[model samples]
Target: MPAMRFFVFALSLAVTSPLLAEEAKPGSPPPERIVEQKIPPLTPPDHELDLLFAQLKKERNPQAARLIADRITSSLFYSGSATVDMLMGNARKATEEKRFGAALDFLDQITLLAPGYAEGWNARASLHYQMGNFPKAMADTAHVLKLEPRHLGALSGLAAVLSQSGRDQQALAALEAYLDRYPADRDAQKRAIDLMIKLDGQRT
Candidate 1:
């Protein structure tokens, strides 16, 4: 059977363990320690993003709320070029077909052509994750964050990779970051709660 990339968790960091490096903080001593510190639980710190998410949460119907959020999310994926759009469409079809190698080929072209586009980086990140190439996926995720720090999708993808890689605490923080922007993601909420329970158990 072909290998499958598994994504079962959410984005984040600034943890207190020696396992993963702490998130860089202002004047953080080299290799800062945050061991035993609880993960920070702040929402996505962007006013515009908060407002959009607020609007999404206020919708009465669940599907409607998802639709609104989807629309908002969709807008983030657009890259205003027909060629890039065509390449991206092809990449999407390849991914759906499980032709991962082909999908990666297309994604490579996308990043090559639109190095500044966050969607290209995000797409590549996702494809790498599906291939179970966590380090490469993470490198792309970093690029996405650099290009668009408000990208919850990228953050969520990062969290999934972290969680599956056995970095539960890092996964918890990343999920919190994702939920800060998308509190309506029920699956993520459940996973975050589960991680909290598991982490708590380890403490005693």
Candidate 2:
């Protein structure tokens, strides 16, 4: 009877010990393994500009394209800094009042404060152009283009600068680039055609 009891106890130990050991084992998987789920990365908020640019490229209607261009311009004007925006406003007022030196000072401060802001360079480029500083205007336009390659204003300004410098072929090429991005601009199309005609006449 003792032997029978011993045998029964051994059988119960053999059956239950492994499960108990496994549960206490270090780094052992639980009875139900939990899989860790991976999270997707968040998209950037600036994708709005990408969507707007895509819409601008696809829209064939001139009036609709103009409206889209206006929106893009408005978006570009926002320097993301209240101080810079205020300086820009002051620069505009100075320009309006023909206070060229004060306007330039404001623009200079804006560029220094926000070197990454393409709008500051663009505004400075326009001011330089108005002041007959073509070289400075051209340099500022180059900075604007580097910061925002798809900037319609910068592309147009680049073309204008090239044309004024008497580089007609280069001017036409720049205009062609502008038209490629925003083909619905009637004025740009006319200007491109005019440049082509002018180039053809010059060749003769």
Candidate 3:
């Protein structure tokens, strides 16, 4: 009976102790509040662009490819920021004017402000290629592909740079990768055919 009474008392104390929290001291600071950040979902691209790519792949016509590629490029420029868009436009204008230095400056600003934007890197890559900076161009082209795997422009750029460097094997690999994503690409098919011939001849 005594042991049972002691057990009962202990159980009551255990249950009640949590309810009897110590009061904060008058001079003590208030408890800190926690905040949670909610990230928004990515927006989808225009369906028309998707359809255009599908058509472009099947047709393999240079004019069709150009139209679809332009649309795809336009779609990729959407960074959800107007400032980034403005900078991109400025960069394009400078590039057209052959002011590679000024174009690169604008692209640098866009990439710095929106590191996630693939177009900025892609634009820089074009400028680098124009200046015969093949290595830099390849690096940026790689980054653009990473940021947007569907960027046909970057894939083609990569293929061109690899070929220009006399790396036929690497060039073939790049074009093959592009074809994997776009099997009906006529230009890549032609390039691949030429590269295969070159590589096979070297083998003997």
The CA lDDT of each predicted structure is 0.74, 0.78, 0.72
Task: Single out the weakest 10-residue window by summed lDDT for candidate 2.
Answer: 10-19
lDDT of 2: 0.78
TM-score of each: 0.71, 0.77, 0.69
**What are the clashing pairs of model 2?**
none
As a TM-score, model 3 comes out at 0.69
* RMSD versus native structure for model 3: 20.1
Off by over 4 Å in 2: 1-45
What TM-score, to 2 decimals, does candidate 1 have?
0.71
> What tens digits encode model 3's per-residue C-alpha lDDT throughout 1-204?
232332232123210122333567999886464344433212235576568667666755566666666776677766776787788889999999999899999999987877777878888988999999998888788777666666777777877887998988777776776675566667788999999999999999
Q: Which regions of candidate 1 fall more than 4 Å away from where they truly are?
A: 1-54, 57-64
TM-score of 2: 0.77
- Write the number of the candidate with greater TM-score, choosing between 2 and 3: 2
Clashes of each: 8, 0, 0
lDDT head-to-head 1 vs 2, winner: 2
